[model samples]
Every structure is written in C-alpha cells, then in structure tokens.
Target: MTNRTFDEMQPGDRAELRRLITADDLFVFAAASGNSNPMHLTDTDVDGNGTAERIAPGMFMASLISAVLGTQLPGPGTLYRRQTLDFHTRAHAGEEVIVRAEVVSKAEGMVRLRTEVTHADGRQILTGEAEVIAPVEKFDREDVEVPGLVVQRHRHFEALLERARPLPALPTAVVCPNEAKSLGGALLAARESVISPILIGEAEAIRRAADEIGADLGGIEVIDVAGDAAAAELACRLVHDHRAAAVMKGHLHTDDLLKPMLDKAHGLRVGRRFTHVFVMDVPGHPEPLFVTDAAINIAPDLATKMDICQNAIDLALSLGMEPRVGVLSAVETVNPAIQSSIDAALLSKMADRGQIKGGQVEGPLAMDNAVDMGAARTKGLKGSVAGRANILVVPGLDAGNMLAKQLAFISHAEGAGLVLGAKVPVILNSRSDSPMSRLASCAVAAIRHFAGAR
Candidate 1:
C-alpha cells in the first residue's frame, strides 16, 4: 500500500550509480545509436562534421537510459504512456553520466515525475517531465542541428587545416611511381592527421620516391604493380574491394587511372559523369573557393553539367559554403551562339525549381561580373548569384580550365583540385600543380571526409 521509492520501484539511477563513460562506452554508444557524429566524441565541433560539438543526440541518451528502464529497472512489465524532453547544453564524453527521476504526484492510475540527466559538471544536459500509467513502460526521446560540420571557422583554410585532428586511419591507395610523391604528401597529411596510405605502385620505385621526398615510408606498404597503368588498375580494385576508403591519384596519367575506374564491370564507377574540381584559396576570398570541370569533360552537356553542379555543391557544403554558384560565361544574356550562356540560364532555373539541392545558381555572367558586383552593375545585371559566386561552372573544358589556370598562374592564386561525385573525394593533381597545392587538395578532402561529405 506504500508508494515505492523512484529507484526502489524502477531502474537504478545512473546518477546514483555514478559511472563514467569510457572509450569503449563512447564507441559502443556511437555504434548502437548511429550517432557517429564526431563532435559528440571529438574536441573540435568546428568543421562540417563537428560543427558545434552539438549536445549529444538526445535519442542516444534517451535510448540508453530507456534500455535500463525497460529491461532492467522496472523490468518486464511497464507501459510508457507519454513524456516530454527539453535539452539545454552538452554532456560530453568521458564525464560521468547521470539519470535521475523524482516522483512528483500520482493519482487515478496516473504517475507524474520530473526527470533529469545531467553532466558531471552539474549542468543539466537534458531535463523534462514524464508521465506513465503506473505500470510504467519504456520511452525514448530524440533535435534540429545537422550532425556533420556545416559551418566554417571565422578564419582561413590554412587555419582550418591547422585545427583538424588525425583521420580514423581509413585505408588509402596511392597510384604508382610519380604519384609516390603524392603518397609523400599523403604521408605528410597522415603525419599530421587522417588518410592512412597504402602505396600501390612498384615497391622499389615507391620507396625511392618516398625517400627522395624525405617522407617516412618505413612503415608504408608496397603493393608492387608493374607500371603506372597496373598501379592505377590495382588502386581502383582496392577501392572496389573495400580495401581502401579513398583513392589518391599519384604520379600516373589521369586518363590511365580513370580508364579502370570508369570500367563498367570491374571499377569504382558509380554510373555518373566523372568531373573535376579545383579547391582554390584566394587572398580575398573568405573560404576556399572551389571550381569544377577543370580537368575532365571537355564540353559537358546539360546532364553532365548537372552532375558537376551537384558535386560542387556537396564540396561547398563540406567547406561550409552557402554554395552560391555562377555559371561563368562572357555575358549574362543567353545569346543563340553562346551555348555557355544558355546552359547557365538552364542550370539556374533548374536550381530554382528544386532540380538542384543545397545551393543557388545563376549563369552567363562575365568573369568580372560574376565575381565583382561593380562589374555586374556596369553590365546592367542584377541578382544574388550574378555576383559573389563561390562555385564557378565554366561553359566548357576550354573556358573552365583556362579560367582556373588564370586564377592560378596569372593571379598567383592558391588552389587545389579533386574529382568528386565518386564514392569519395578523389585527389587528382597535375604535375604542374605545386606540392603545396597537392597538399592543400588533400587537406580539403580530409576536411570534407571528416565532415562526412559525399
């Protein structure tokens, strides 16, 4: 006839038990809850993956506590009627996690209780009210924030790279011979952060290149393909077989590497048009400026252009850019002879009608008009994407490649290029591309990968 104590009648409180989450605990919870959001586990919640170190997924903690409430505490016979949860701050990992329920009132077969799950710092991470029909049942509660890094730091890309932590040691394959230097860059990237490398060229050549580059190839594994062609084929196979998560284009011809990748039967081709992107760092631009179709697709039609736009949008999202795209051309009007101008108009409208996702697009703007508002005004054009464009979709390979090179050579801009829309961010740098540029591309890909970018 006496009312039972909250703990006595229900599951033992984690608060009362006073337990701390270990590395194992974090890993288990992450796997079990599908809350692989790094911010909940890592130190920086800054990148697209860890944007704000968000308060852990409420569903994660609620489910964890509910397991105890249903299976162990109240055990076997409980009916969960209703409950409301309010989340405030973050209950980061490693700290002791607490769950407590205070019985408030019970009448007419209804039980009302105030519940709280607080961090060890005594700050309440989750607090709310719960109600049940006396024969209490298990209940779960779940938020607005996107899980990956979607916001950029108020600083520079170099600074952002400085802030990045080591990658998860995911397998990486480096194309042979000359690309061994790329493997060296990967090594530098790994020496500092994520992207574990598996060199797939001739062992002797890979080591020799690694040694000349002064990279730590001691622990590096050599797959020993006969030549660049074989190495590229092997690299693609590794990715297809799941041996590597990312494929890096090392000292091999882009055409040779892509031949195997695009093979319908035995490669990593996902049946989409293969496109290229160059991540450029300009002194005046706030974030890394990424341009696309620079290295592939001589003159993409509407279909291929769509893929290029989408891929750039994903990369921009990873870079925390709002993805304002400008289809670069000589003029804003869709002149009959100017196919680029027409394509730009179509792409922009496609974006407006929801054909494109996660960004805005406009086209046929002159280079000066696309980048400089004053230039746009002088040309008597007006629109958001007409000026201040972040992702430039050039009309053809000629225009796109030429425009990108001007930004690099003539203006001396800093840029890195990658091929996207693949399973992962593909690192494809030309020999003309400086070592620093190659490293920059790798850093951008790492940031994008950690951010869970496509």
Candidate 2:
C-alpha cells in the first residue's frame, strides 16, 4: 500500500478498484450494518417474482468509494469531509462493478475527488463525489489482511430440495404424525412437493396437530390407527403393498417404527441391515458431510460396520456424490489395543478388495485428519479419503451420535437423517429438528427413491 501526500496531489490523479458481488457479501454486509431489508438479501423475493434478485444495497456500492480513498488515491490516512451519491441504476450479486476515484481539486488542506461506480458493461450504477483530508506525510506499507467470513447457510440442503422438486412426489407413509412438530414437518414437505404423505396415526390427534400448526388437512389421506405400533405396522404394510414408496417416522419411537419393518414374513427389509446416515450441510464446507450409524447400530461388529459403510456409499452415490469414507478412530495409526483402529484398517483393506464398493475408503483417521487437509498432511497420511473424506464412519453409535450432534449444535450445521439399506428409503427426523431439517430429510428420501427408480 502506498499513499499520496497532500502536497503531492495533482489534478487528474486517479485510482480504481473492481469487485465482484457475491451472495455471501450481501449477507456479511447485512450482518455488519444491521440492515436486513429483504431487497438486499440473497434469498428474498420482495416483488413476488419467485426469483431472488439479490440486489446490492446502494450503500454497499458507496462503500467502494471509501475503499478507494482509504487504500488507493489519497491512499492511507485519509479522512472524509463530505460525500454525495447519486444512484443511476441497480447492481446485483454476481455482477462485477468498477469503482473509480479521480482527483478534482485541492484547497484548504482538503482534496476533492470525483467518484463513480459502473457495471462492467459500461452502464453507470452509482455516481458520487468525495471530499477528504489527504495525508500530510507519505504513507507506505504492506497490505493488511483481514479474516474471511463464512455465511451460515444450508445451501446443500437447498440444492437437494431443488433436485427433488422435478421428480414426482414420493408417496410416503408417515407413521404416528400426531404431534405439531412431526405433522407439521410432513406437511411442510408436502407443500414443497417433495412427498405425498399418507398420514397413519390417530385421526383426532393428527387433526389436533394440524390445528396447532394452522395447517389444512383437506384432500390429504389420513388413516386412523389407535396405537403407535399399529400405525407403524400399517405403514410397513403400505410399503409392502407398494402403496407407499418411502417410510417416514413421525412422533413415534424408532424401535416401534423399525420393529415391523424387520419382520421376516412381511417387512421392508432387504438383506443388508438398516443403518442411519445424517447428511449434514455444515457452513463453509465445500461439500455435504455424511455421518453414518449415528441414530442406529450400537457397537457394530465387523459385518455390521461393512453394511454401514456400503449403505453410506450407496446413499452418497444416489445423491451424485463420490463417497470418500473415513473410518474414524482415536488415532491415525493402528494400535493392537485400540479395537477401532484395527477395525478401521480392516475396513480399508476390505474396500481395496472390492468388498465395500463405490467409494475410496481409508481408516484409522482421527477426527482432525479425516476432514482437514492440514491435519492429514501433518500426520504424513497419503490416501484418497484420508483428508478429503465426506463420509465419516464412526467406531460406534456413541461416537457417531456425538459427532453429528456436535456438528449440528456447535458447528451450526443442518442435518437430514435417513435410514438406509432397507427396500425403500426411511426418512428419520428428530423432534427437535428445525422445519428445514425435517423438510430436507424428506427431500433426501425423495431423491434417493427417484435415483433408484432411474
């Protein structure tokens, strides 16, 4: 960085900078300025046009002028005296704009400059003038670095919903949707056209739940079943009869829901045991993160862990992701005393032998090395899945559950839970899940269902 002194300033001296507007920039600006008007937000449609314009805030364009004054032209140690702005047109996220400042005059230890911002196509967006006190002494220094910001947005889930929207809604048997949270979540997915829900629960309780959420249950199927177990059984029957393509847990214990599905005589079970996967959209992560056996499979043995890995890999492939499985353990190296490390090493070898298909599998990775390049490099680990693993296969249920929850609560990730390896996808959602989380679960199930159909 270099600055011009007041005495050295001359007419026609100019400086300019170009910036490409991004959706995150709008969010960051909104957060920093406390101006959350929908017009300046990335996900809002103020005109009822159904498309988000993501218009850049006018003040944001004006701020570019300040950037020029502080860093360029009168480069450093510049103090603002007065400024005037005139808006000509609009700028939006994803557009590039050039901000320019030119020296106009100097008097009374103050420098006046003509400032303007224009689109890359030569269309003017903002015209402005700035008056500032130029630095008395020449200033020169290295550029200062500032920390980057990541907006806590669940874009992965959003993309999943978008991909599922084009498919025919999956006919889902929602077992025991007798509470506001559960019923409302199913209905929300219905509204989004992700699922066509067949409500299987007590009619009166379902109606009450609809009332609580102010949701209309008109034209939607409602099967009256007295007990939770009965409703779950009926849902399983629906899947067996091919009336429903997916099973959704609603306001019922997971054990009750899966017990009927596990029946040998009449069940939704395939050969593989049921395994749970949480598809998480963590903020700032470049890709979706998958945690397996989080809600099921306690203390899984070698065979069960193989099923877990294969199920997760299948789910990832269904979602168009190339699975990179990281069997997490206490340490990156195998220790004979550490059962998890041994299991991880065995899983890696099994994957190499084509036992666990459709993924790059590596194991005995601590949590840090599994997802972080720096940690993986520090440990001198070299494998396709060592550092870039998207699917984290924990040693047991306890570890998987804790890791998923930590990402959800502490890392501010939104998760969509699903039970895989069944004949059909099972949408599993928690009572404490947000509406988006619930909807995302249904969306994931719908996508997986359609992908299998194809």
Highest TM-score scorer: 2
Per-residue error (Å), model 1, residue 208:
1.6
User: Candidate 1, residues 163-217: lDDT per residue as tens digits?
Assistant: 4555565467878644445666777766765567888877877777777877666
Error of 1 at 376 (Å): 1.9
User: Lowest-lDDT window of 10 residues in candidate 2?
Assistant: 40-49
Angstrom error at residue 77, model 1? 92
lDDT accuracy of residue 246 in candidate 1: 75
Estimate candidate 2's RMSD in Å: 1.9
Q: Please give, for residues 222-248, the per-residue lDDT of candidate 2 as tens digits.
A: 999999989988988898889999999
